[model samples]
Structures are given as C-alpha cells and as structure tokens.
Target chain A: MTDAPKAAPATNSRAGTKKELSEHFKTYKHVWVFIECEYGVIHPVSLELLGEARKLADKRGVSLAGVILGSDANLIAAAATVCFEHGADLVYTVTDPTLAHYRNEAFTKGMTDVVNTYKPEILLLGATTLGRDLAGSVATTLLTGLTADSTALAIDDEGSLAATRPTFGGSLLCTIMTLNYRPQMATVRPRVFGMPPREPGRRGEIIAHPLNLAEDDIVTKVLQFVADRDSNQSQLAYADIVVAGGLGLRSAENFELVKALASVLGAEYGGSRPLVQKGWITADRQIGQTGKTIRPKLYIAAGISGAIQHRVGVEGADTIVAINTDPNAQIFEFAHLGIVADAIKLLPALTEAFRKRLSVNRLAS
Target chain B: MHIVVCLKQVPDSAQIRVHPVTNTIMRQGVPTIINPYDLFALEEAMRLRDLIGGEVTVLTMGPPMAEDSLRKALTFGADRAVLLTDRFFAGSDTLATSFALASALTKIGQEFGVPSIVFTGKQTIDGDTAQVGPGIAKRLGLNQLTYVARIVELDRDANKIIVERRAEGGVQVLETRLPVLITMLEGVNEIRRGSLESAYRAASAKIVTWNAAAAGITDLTKCGLKGSPTIVKKVFAPTPRAEKAHQVPTDGLAPEALADAVIAEIFSRQPSVESDLVRFSAGQ
Candidate 1:
C-alpha cells in the first residue's frame, strides 16, 4: 500500500552546508570485474570483460582487479592466471566449499563482502545466467545502481563510469551513469567485446580472502549438474558463418530451404526471434539480443525484417547478405548486400549454385 | 504450495510498427495483452497448482485499462487477481518495477500466506532485458531460478525444488529451496482455456485495485523514475547499410545459368565459403 512520505529527522547539523566539488569527486577508485566460474572453466564473457576493463583502467590510470569466489583455491588461482593473461592486474579471491557451485545466497554474500572490503569504483560482470543471478543480488544488497547488457564502457571527464547499452528492445542506444553510487556496476553480453590475445607468461597479484560462509549456512544444495549433451548443443554462437531464416520464409517446411543453404555454406543455422516465438524454431537457434550474439565472418539473413535486437546480434559480422521480398525491409538497411526477391525461390537456387561451384573448384584444384 | 504469478500487460510487440515517414514507433491502435511469455508462466503455475492443490494469484502493474489482462488471467483459472495502478507508478524501469512488486508480495503474504513459489515470464517482449525477475528476487530475498525449462520435482513439505535450467551450452539440473522466484522459459507448458463458467466469473470479478499509498510504499522517491537508476536518453531507428544486394539476373536466362550467376555472386562476396563447402561435402 502507498504511504505519505514522512518528515526526516535532521541527523546532520550541517544539512545545508555546501561541500567543495573537488573534494566530493575523489571517492572513485580501481575497476573491478566479477569473474564467473562454474564447474571448472571460467565463462569466456568474464575474460572478455577483463579485457574491456583493462582498456578502461588504462584510460583512467587505474588498476584492473578481478573478484572471484569458489570452493577450490587452485581453480581460482588458475582462473586468476587466465585473467592476468587477458588483463587483470590483481585477483581478489574468496574460497569456501559452499561456493563450489553457484547458489545466490553464498555467491552473493561472498561477492558483497569483497566489494565492501575493497571499494572498487567500477564493477563488471558477464551477462550470463549465473552472472545475472548474482549481479542483481549483490548490487541490491549494496544499494547501488547497476546497468545490464552494456555494449560499451568508458570513463568520462568527471572520472565516472559511463555505460552505453541498447534499450527498448534494441531500438535505441542509451548511455547510463551511476553518479552518486560508489561502485558503478554493469553486465555485458557474451561476444560483444573482442577477446584480448593471451600471454601465458603474464602474472597478477592474488589476494586470498577468507569466505566466512559454510555448507550448513547455505540453504540450497547442488544435487547434480546435467550438462547438455554435445549432440543437443546448438553451437550457434561460435559459428563462423551463420545462415538464419525469418518469417518471410512462410511455412515450417520452407525453413528446410534455409537449412539447405546453410549446409552448403558449412555454417550453423538459426532463425530470427519471431520464428522462435512462432514455434518454427527452438530458442537455441534464435539469433537476436535476447537469444544469441554471433561474430561470424559472413552471415546470410533470409526473410528477416532486421529489428534492432536482431541487428545488434549480427552487427559484428564481417559481411552480411540479406534476401527478402520486401524492398524496404529493415534487413536491407544493415546488410552489406541486399536482394529484393522471394527467399523460397532464391534459397534453393543459391544452395544449388554453391554446390556446383564447390564441386567444380574441387575438381579443378 | 500456493503459487503467485506476476504478470504484466504489454503492448503486442508484433503489432508495433514504425511510422513510414517519421521513422518513430506508432503506438496508436496497438492492443494490449498479457505478455506472451507471461502466459506460459501462468500456465505452468496453474498446472503446478493443480498437482499440488493450492491457490494461484495473478498480479499485474499497469494503467487502469490493464484490469482487462487481470480478468483474462482469472478466466485461465487463477484463484484471484490484483491490479496495482497509480499515476505515480508510470515511467518505472525494471528496478522501480521490482521494488513495487516486492512490496505487493509482502502484502499478499500478510493477507494469505507466504507463497511457496513465485513465477514470472523469462522476460517481457517489450523490455527484453530479463532483469525484472532477478530484480524482484533481489528485493524479496528469494532464491532465483531463471530460464527454467522444466520443474523436475517439488516437495513442499521438504521445502525443496528441482528444476532443469536452460544455460548457454546446456541444461543444469539444480535443486534449490522453496520460496524461490522462477522465470519460466517458453515451451515449458501450453496454456489451457477456461470453461464458460470460469469466463463468466472473470468477466464480473471485482479485481482488487491498489494505489501507491495503498500498496504500503512509504518512500515516494523509490516508486517510479526516482527509484530507477537507468535512463533512456535517446531512441532511434537502426541505420541502413551502405550497399544494396548484388542482384543475379534471371530474365531470359536458363535455370542452370541463373544458378551459376547466383553462385558467382556469393563466391565473389565470400571466397572462403568455397573451402568450407569442400569440408561440408567431405562429411556428406
């Protein structure tokens, strides 16, 4: 129920006193990234964040630190080594058996403790399922502002972290600032940033901290982890060349044309978010902001309208070819090459052409 | 084993279109419906309630017109519906939105009982951030299970829940405690239609309406834009690419010639695809 705002008791005798702007701006410090680790391997997005953090740290003349919490010290150390090679200057670790698997209760507690103890001005995390689960909790517990799925991060003239991200279903981009918050927090999607080259000989300082949490204190238990079978995996995100279908394809059977083209291209295949919503494709094959971000060398978008969410996902491609019947389809706006034609007719023709071309090239070679 | 579902009335995204001349979203004549994803959540919640023998309450936050969505929820066999509407609640982002929902949940707990579980769709099609569910869990201190494809088991008496969570590469079978917030993925369950009697009851049901002052929100600054940290300063249409598609002429051309011309264009754009095709054919 709504209630009227109550009058505040004056706790500060100098409530009206003005403070100097220069003195007020000195609270910001080093940038910190939340290193998301599960099972044993660290999520690539975590390393990617570290790489971006390294650039921001250099620009701001500050150190890049990584915050990691888990059960095994050795695993954390290994992760820290990878972070160092990617770019972290220091790794703050909290180890406890309760943290072996990700439980919001324990992971949030461990992370908040690290943040409060070491007041980093900027914090970054991967926008993965586990990272999102923990980032919101930790940010809320600390009563700070957080930006999600940021596409860009920069240090402004005021020494504040400015996070730019797509908004309103990728219709627009907005830059958000947490001016009053001590630590500016953000979550970035995978593959949005390029991975830095690894230097195995690189090293960083590891600050081992005690995790006061225990197993009994943790309320949730990990009964088991059923890793998705390799055969069932979509591998859409890692595809070098992706052929995606859209509503323009018309029927479920028509999707086979896109698949045939993808087969000849030797690329993974997917569809627009609309197709997924229409039940024509599974969620795994949906290529869009909410679905997947791909960085293929080439992308063939057939019958897609190219909404902002879908555009953001494929903007990283080196070359994009769009095939659609609508001359003014949004897909053509962003495509490197566009054809105004029926995908149903063009798809099969394209597939056959590729088949013959490759066979002839093979014979000649 | 009572379950509470938080639903939102969203503009049908598929119907949303940008003005041809102005290049701005024309929200006019866009019909509002229960967010498509939320329907799946409601269905899963109802199915669970049927199996576990408990009441299901459907709650929504929107303009007064959103009452229609709540009534629709009731037609789907929801035991009760609540609508939290207030002018001050407008422009609330996910952060402010979650804070308001969390307070309403507290009210629901006092009146009925603390829900054994709370459900929301993975994300609203309009927002597409998938943050509000996590935001609500953070405020209420609920165990969050997101992207849940299946609920493997639930033992209320033992305070346990096992679910198969959809992850980037695979599914994770996680076991957590009750009183958790779960954002159900699509394809978890198909929504069932209500009988005639249920539809009639929904049509005439007096869905409870609450304002900001009545929802137990004491802080005015934490209710709407004041409470939200993120702000959208600009909105624009996507920029068009610089080049047009290379057309393969089919006029007066044979099928084989047309196919060859198209192939030449594709190879001219991406020569490396030839080698990739070689590898693929080798497998075939």
Candidate 2:
C-alpha cells in the first residue's frame, strides 16, 4: 500500500542555548531514584539503580536519594535503610495504606507532589511495569522530559542527566538530554546496572514526604493480585547462567532440548521473542529488550539469529556462545563462541555431553 | 461505542542495519510498515466495533505519507482515518508528540463524535519508549491501561471496561470506565485481511488531513521541537566487541564427539565457569 512519499524530517532542531534554560530550574538539586517495592520486598531494579545513580551523583558532586512509597511506615523505614546500604545518601518517602499496590493515579500524584516540592536535577526509576506506569504519568504531570528504557545514565558536560538508550528499534544508541527541564527523568531497564555491594550499618538521612492522595481519589482499584501460575518467577533477570533458544529450535518439542542443556549445566532456560510469540514459552521466559534483560556469567543461545532487540538484552553476558546454522547470523558478530550447526541436533548432543562430564566429575569427587 | 486507534508508521526494524565504519543507521533500503504492534491494536478496535454498534476511527501524526497507513487501516474495516501532519510538528519527541496527538483527538471529538475508547500499540518499534500512550492519556485525562493481554469485557451500556494487563510476573485483571486509553500488547489476536469489497471501499475513502492550526492547537511554540524538552545529542552504533565469536571447527566430528570437544574447549577457556556450574547444578 505504499503511496506518495514526503521528505523525512531533518533530525537537528535542538533549541539553542543556556538562555532557554530558566533560572527557576537552578533551584533543583540532587539525584533521586524511586525505590519500588511489591508485597514488602524491594524490587531488585531499585537496588540496581542505586549503584548507577551513585556514579552519576559522584560525577556531579550531588547527594543521591531514594524515594520509597509504601503502605506502612515501619516497612518503608526498613526499605529506606536498605537504600542507604545500597549507596543512597538520603531517602525521601511516603507511607500510606493506599500506596501498597501500584495504582497509577495515586502514585503519580504522590511522586509529582514530592518532585514539585523538592526538585531534583535527576530522577530515576526502574523500567518495571509499576515504574513505567508511574514515571510516564508523573513526568507528564510535572511537564518534564522522561527518557524510557535507558541502558545508561550519565552526567553530561552541562551537568544534565544524559540518558542513553537503544533507539530506532535498537539498531543504534542515542543519548537524550532534558536540557531545560527540572527533575530530568529516566527509567532504566533491569539488569542494565550492577547491584552495588551493601555497606552494612551504613547510615543515611531520611526525609518522609506526605502523600496527598486518598483511596477515593484514585479511579482504578486493584481487584486482586494474581500471582503467575508458573511461579518460577522469571529468575532470568538475576540468573547467573542462561541458556536461550529461538525459532531455530524448529518446534516447542525441540525447545525442551534447550531446557535439557540448561538443566545439565545448572542454568536457567529462556528463548527469543518469537518463541514467546509462538506460545512455546511464557512472556517471562522471553529475553530481549522488550523482555527481561540479563547479565548472566554465561549465555548459550541456540538457533537465535540475534536481532538488535535481543542483542541489547544479552550484550552484558560475560560469555555468549551462539549456535546457528547460518554462519552470517548477527549473533555470531558479538558472541564469544560461535558454532555453525543445527541447534536441533547440537542442543541434545550438548546436553548429553554435559551430563556425562558433570556426572564423571561428581563420581571422581 | 465510538473508538479511536492511534497508529504509527515505522521502518521495518528487521531490515534496518548500521554502518560499520560510520556507526550510523542505514534506513535507506528499509521499508516502512504500519508499526507491527499497532496492527494488533487495530484488529482489536475493529473487532469491538463489529461486535458493538459503533465507529472505529484511525489516527496518526507523521509525514504526509503516513496517510498510507491510515488508508491501510480503512481496508481492515476502520470507518474513518485522520492524518495529523505539519512542519510545525517536526522534531517532536514523545512529550511533544503526545501533545499534538491529544490536541488532534480533541478536535476529532468536536468534529466526529466523542470517542469512548482510544487504542494504541504497546509501543512503536522505532521509539521503543512506550511512553506516548500514557502521556496522551494523562494529557486527555483518560484512564490508561498498558500492555493489555486481553479485553475480558467491554460494557458499552454500563460505560465500563475490564482487561487483562501484563504486570511483572502476573496478569492484573483491571476494571475501568469508558473513555480509557488502552495500549494493546502484541499478539493478542491475529490481524485480519480485507475482503475485496472492503479493499475497494478503502481505496475510495476520503482521508481527513489536519495541520497544527487546523488540529486546534493554541500555542505555536508547543507544537514542534520548541515544545519537546528532550534533545538527542549523540546517535551512534554500539562499539563492536574486540574479540568476535571464536568459531568451533565442526569439520570432522560426530554429534557426540563435537559436543565433547566443545565442552572441553569451554572448560579450558573458562575453568572457573566449570566449577561455578558444578557448585550450582549439583542440587546446591
């Protein structure tokens, strides 16, 4: 259905100058990370952000803080302490019963209120479902720029938060700057940052912010929290080693072969986007940009000709072993090890070999 | 039950590549498709309109050529198509883009009946930000449901909607009022092709075109690059790994032998991984 075409818009029109950078925004200071928790347990991405923000905070010579929103005061106080242990210099929080389950309306209003009262130069959030839902609404409410799914966050030359993310469908990377906005906001994907070592007995300042939202104000309600049927809980996010397959496995039956290898090697099993689309695996088992990002010590990919979307997810792997029939597969370009063979055959053989080797080692020991 | 679906035309990411030396996106040969994600949304919207007595209007903000995507939507049973394109809308980021689209939606309501629901793809592949749908919902004061796996129920008479929304590890069955913005996750349903008769009607359909002023936008500064707060300072391909994939020779080995050789090679290269694997996989 391609028809008449128009010239593509020229990509250059950045509003020139420090003149547009208003004086009122100068009052904004420090970097803030939204410490998201569900059912009392702090999401690991929140801890990951503390480390990333710590670096940016040090670069700009500013204090780093975590904003914890929860339903109970005591539970939130404990979460705030963990933030201190994970590199945050201070904690800003609000504890209200309504804050328990993530409702976009209440959380957005609460976060927006805090940002307006105590502006920060940079505000970070995990790119989780809760964080994304809140960040978009909050950023819109604050009338600021928000860079989403950022792979990297840094302090620019002008002391602005420079958020780097894969753009154009991960074909390339672009650094975004919210030049004139207060609370330059960004949502970093999980596993993009390492968990900074906790300093036991670390102390930090705690500031409790008041949340104005009440139950009656929110339009949406959490009818119930439905835990997934398959409660393996998508450990791919934190798995030390992952074995992933793609459509190259040929069928869901063949997918079990990938899982067999992972089992023998004592690693987690995952697949590319297509396998998830084919219903061979649940969405949580999908690994790529749109799925869980992983930084395992070892990643074995079979039959997956890496798309940029999947490439971004696995690039952090300490070692990547690619198996595909196509020698020119994009996975081969970056994989530490490559094999030109059918994953259907190679996976099963690999599983048997690993089983024998591991068993022999166990017997000898 | 008037529904509006937001559509975007993006380059086929599968065909897109990067320049090795220059590290620039080579979009020269890639064909533009109606962002594949949006098709899922279009199908859902059309299905609702078919089930209920209503109209399905498709809208998008891109170059003049984006009208082709709208026309294609019509072929899939959309009743009307609106294209919002203007030079004043160029260089807009997600924030500015949402502002323009929301303004256009308001005008569409004033012109053609108020829409009860606004549907959009979870995210555009080109942007991959997944921010615009929520931004628009916020601007227009619509209840936003994102990454929806299924529409469990839509009660036009009761002015309510229930959907299965994908959360971190679970699906949230959320209920909301009408006039909500729903961003459909991919693969909820297969897109249907048009019948020949429908294709004929789509070819002859009159597409509505709106410029910034025509779209009822009040401020000029908030229309384009001036409105956008985020600026891209650098766009480059990621640096390649220094050590490329080391190929394992598979010339003269049986399947078992090949596997054994590969395992031995892996151990020799990463002796620590062998110990690490042993410790974890040994039921520890």
Tell me each candidate's RMSD, in Å, in order: 5.2, 3.1
Interface quality of candidate 2 as DockQ: 0.50
TM-score for chain A of every candidate model? 0.89, 0.92
How do the residues A6-86 of candidate 2 rate in per-residue lDDT, one tens digit apiece?
A: 112114445223446688999999999999887888999999999989999999999999998889888888998999999
Highest DockQ: which candidate?
A: 2
Candidate 2 displacement at residue B229 in angstroms: 0.7
The 0-to-1 C-alpha lDDT of every candidate, in the order given, reads 0.78, 0.84
**What does DockQ give for each predicted structure?**
0.39, 0.50
- Cα miss at A324, model 1 (Å)? 1.2
Query: How much is the lDDT of residue A57 in candidate 2?
Result: 92
- After superposition, the stretches of candidate 1 with alpha carbons farther than 4 Å from their true spots are A1-26, A231-234, A361-365, B19-24, B241-259, B279-284
What interface RMSD do all candidates show, one decimal each?
Answer: 8.2, 4.8
Error of 2 at B246 (Å): 3.7
